[model samples]
Target: MVMVEYMDNVKLGMLDGFLTRNHQKSLKSLFSRNKSPNANDNGDDDPSSAALNSPKSIPQLSPFANSVVSRCSKILQVPTEELQHHFDTQLPESVKELLTYARNFLEFCSYQALHILSSHPDYLNDKEFRSLTFDMMLAWESPSVETKPQDKETTCSNQEVEDEDGWSIFYSSSTNMAVQVDDKKTVGPEAFARIAPVCAAVADIITVHNLYDALTSSSDHRLHFLVYDKYIRSLDKVIKASKNALASSIENLQLTEGEIVLDVDGTVPTQPVLQHIGMSLWPGRLTLTNSALYFESLGVGLYEKAVRYDLATDMKQVIKPELTGPLGARLFDKAIMYKSTSVAEPVYLEFPEFKGNSRRDYWLDICLEILRAHRFIRKNNLKETKKSEVLARAILGIIRYRAVREAFHFFSSHYKTLLAFNLAESLPGGDLILKTLSSRLLLLNSGAAQHDLSGSPHAKWQPKLSPVSLIALTQLGFMLQKDVHLDAEAIIVGDVCVGEINPLEMAVKQSVLDTGRAEAAQATVEQVKVDGIDTNVAIMKELLFPVIELASRVQVLASWDYPCKSTAFLMLSSYFILRGWIRYILPSIFVFVAVVMLQCRHFNKGKPLEPFRITPPHNRNAVEQLLTLQEAITQVEALLRSGNIILLKIRALMFAVLPQATDRIVLLLVFMAAVFACVPLKYITLLVFLEAFTREMPYRKESSDRWLRRIREWWIRIPAAPVQLIKPDDRKKKKSLDDRKKKKS
Candidate 1:
């Protein structure tokens, strides 16, 4: 009776399931779409080809699914209706919907089974059916057999469909889609698809078991064990299949003329061609051969080709090791960065620990050995050339490498100095330094006999003088002293042996002797020039010659009596001209014009420069003379306290230390100006127009007081008429009112 029942189930499965006329039609349609005329012409009897051509449709009464379902039902003694009811009440809305679909599909299966059984009565007693049924009931479990007609016009070639139960649908080919069921997300479709029907049957079995337990208050351990056993077997099959596929992929790579030394599972980063950004990681197998390194992605099709790196061609490439941290240890310990000569950036390959050894270190050592061997081979190949020629070429290569390295270092240091120059040039005293140097240059070229240092005896001493010493002497007003001797290499001012000319330290020391506090100044200069004074002092002395002369001129101007107004005016004009021309020509001209305009306005407003209104009566007494001397002392103290003289001295000292500071700053500014000039002229004109329209003018009414307002108003009237035509009535009236108010007070 049992054999008869098995035979009946087998016949029903074969007649109503995948072998049915409808399934054959679907298979024929799929084959026709993929078939070529050449494939039809070949009558190959290969088992693999036959298997590939076989219909992949699933069968009804599948051994894997049906066995689990039948065993659980028999143990629980639950009807199909009871299981469905339990599922409806206990499952979520989504699961309930899936249950409904399954039930509808099962009803269709039953109707078809009945139709087949009625039509083929002779299949009931077939021995072949009985044997096939027994075999299926024992162990047969396979994937589903749902067939959907392929849409050739579909835009999406490989759309992924997934469900909440960790079930995924993959397009197995352009004409077919397959479903896979797995514990986690990483399992391949082929493995899980083979067991998908079994999974569905297990779901049904579990529902029935739970329902029976709820009703009887008893758990069926036998049914539970059977379900778990089937699941474990299914997972085992998946693992074996995955390993086989991996081996097949590795074999297909076809490495060139080398034995594989090492093979490991790892990941390599993939970057798009042409684009410079966005790297994606692909998990793959890494194989190191004697001749090359290869990486094959675990996936099929385009990914199976595997990227190859030839050891000989990439001899100069460097491999860098990087530790990605503890979290990344699961995937890899260290990543190897390979810089390809053809690519803009390096490609990274990460390796996990392989068999208790560090894969990164092992791979790196292998690559180093290969590189060393390649270098040796290359060296031997060069024996054909003359030894002398080879030696000369090698020497030239070494020199070129060193030259490039030193040039890079020099540029880096100078770049830092250039930045410092830019920062200093923006300060207020920076303008003064430039002006002072310009005036000295002008004085030297003006044919002034007193300023001609080139023919002076002290000119010879200038070469020996360090910039620090020159600065110290200038600060002490030594340049203006008449009793200075420069006949010898040693600088001498009066009786002092200031400094010697040979070594910079000696020169600076000798120059410091001219200062009143020689010892302290010498010590300070030594401390500042600690990093070898020769280069810095020589560069400074050469570049800042004009600045030193200007410092002397400043001292001379300060000492002058300015006995007449005309003399003082002429001196002030010359100073302004020299300062303005060097630092900022346009702005200085505007300033000078503004000053002259204000003076003219003052004259037109009937405001004359007045002398002191109250003066003490002249006295020839000694007490009066003493008072005058005390007043002079107070004025000198005030000038000193104001810090102007000290600031000027500091500026001059800075020039001595940074001799090329002005030149570097000017060069940078000019470069920036040139860059700006390259912009469209219209843009510059627009910017200037906008500034003029929006910027607050210096002589605006809000900024001016009553006296300034009168002066500006007088100037405004001059442009409309001659000087006499402008009326001073308003100014005179205001002045009279002010006088009356002063009298009343």
Candidate 2:
């Protein structure tokens, strides 16, 4: 955190520029809708956003609060009046003073309501449930016009200091207040995480902040009601379309039981999916299921037999974005390359877009999600319905991500992606989150765990059985696994209790905080990168100047550039090596470096690091650089080819490809082994040392040259093994393309 603050100083201008750009863009968008708007985010309106646009729609509690409360009532199955009465009666007087405190009330109602709704089979698919819950988030962002200002003034003017507990100390510091709320009444990440997960379909508590960050990234990393609403609405459409698609896939694609269709493309002739198998490209309909990828090649007027790409089972699957082009030349970066032990070769699924590869990226993300989810299942060894729960969670998260990407036309960056598995993989301390999730999953049923967690229940706090999310998905008609029979009396509570933080949630929060620091650190790193190869090399050289100077002296000694120094240095090194003091010399150098660092730290206490000074190397033009590169490449290629040929000859000798060569190599190896057996290692080392030491001596020069020449002649006489190249069956590919060209012609 301290380092992040320091890094922030390094990239303050960059962050400011970023926020300013997004802020202006957001303002412009909102201004087009509203006569006058807030400076922070461009709020959306289906209910709350709609109210924000019209001054007349403002009410006593504001449509935002009313919408939230109304949704809460439905979840609680209580009337709105009774809900408000409960809130008024149950909450603390100090907390209930402002609309901001209403978030706590909303959390209470929404969480409990979510717990109840999560059990309903149709809750995830229910359009009204999604609309209401997301509307609650939108409403949470910007409240009633009257209440918003009042709350803002109340927060700012409340200087009445009360540190009744050690809490008020947390509220102020260098500037009057330790922590202060911003004037802009936007929903915070914490609030989003707390409320968004009310519907398992909306968010998972573990990755809610990431989802929020993804949803809000374009609006200066502030949640906008518009983005949230569009995302939820898009998700609703996607879910419904997927359900509809199942009916059609049932006849053609024999989907595995509990396999929910995720997405399908290439149904239209104009936007056909191009599938490349060992170079052959075919247009086809590609369907992504909960478990695998199904490709049905378009043939004659009918689709050929569907090719299933297993994602659920472990077949050493590797899915990544790769370049694909006509004839498999890899000229275009618009394909998902899938390679697995199950498939004969890598399959390229190309989504042709004239511009950026959004289509490819989309497919890549969804496919990886299923891949990673199954991996998680495998890694954790989840069985039966537990597998279903994990799979369903992944399914919902992907749906949410799809909704956001398609609706907002914006992609969440690495740290803020919505896919749970992807987010976990990318986030720092993410393994801890996964571990916590594994523990959480163990509490899915039975009201109690049978496993001996160190022997007794009274000795340790046991986790409660709460699988509301799984229940929600099951109710939504996904039917992920047949093994899970929901207990009617199972405790319907959130993974997180009202006043307590779940271990998984805490892990997520920690990861989120670490991610913020990582982003800040990355920003500073980006700022410090010197442009151009010459400049960067110059900086590197300057940083390593001491090491370079030492190396130069050693080089001078080795080449005997100065006879006196060379003789003295050689004597000293040889004495050290012979005396077995070489080991201590490196340790001594390490100690010296450590002392220097500590001394520097002591001398420069409370000060910044001194900037290294360096002058860039002379710049070379393209032609000069190219000429140098060509010369280097020529030398390197010759060396590599020579090395490879020698390796091949050695391989041939080992495999007895040639009888004489193999017999000679075997004899030589046997002799060497006999010598090694007979001789001590010390004698061998001494002999090697003496040979290297005397190689350039005048008396031994002739003999050494004769031996080297003989060895070179012998090596030249040894023949390289015969090699053959295997070309894949690409005739079908050529034929396919040739036919297509002819048809076009």
- On lDDT, the leading prediction is 2
Cα lDDT of model 1 by residue, 1-745, tens digit: 2332232222222222122122212211321324332333256454433333332222333333333333222212233333334434433343235323442223222222222221222222332222222222222212122322112121112233645632222312211221221111112222222222122111111112221122112112111211222232333333233335335544666743222233334433442111111255556666554346667666653456667766655346776565442333334446676666754665667665435324455455445444433443354443211221122222222222222222221111111111111211332233342233222222121110112244332221111111222222222222312223322111111101101111212222232233325445557678645222234545566567777887766444443333244346445555644454334667888998899999889776877545323223433466665776688789989988656544653454446434454455568789979968796554554455433322233333244355567755643332211123435887798899999999999
Clashing pairs in 1: 58-145, 64-140, 498-510, 498-511, 499-510, 499-511
Minimum summed lDDT over a 10-residue window in model 2 is located at 13-22
616 Cα displacement, candidate 2 (Å): 3.8
Clashes of 2: 10
- Each prediction's Cα RMSD? 43.3, 14.7
Name model 2 segments beyond 4 Å from true. 1-106, 116-184, 446-463, 481-491, 516-544, 600-614, 617-623, 645-745
694 Cα displacement, candidate 1 (Å):
54
RMSD of 2: 14.7
- For 474-525, candidate 2 gives per-residue lDDT tens digits of 6666666676565433334446443346678888889988988999999989
Residue 327's lDDT within candidate 2 is: 92
Residue pairs with clashing backbones, model 2? 44-49, 44-226, 45-49, 45-50, 121-475, 121-476, 171-178, 172-177, 172-178, 173-178
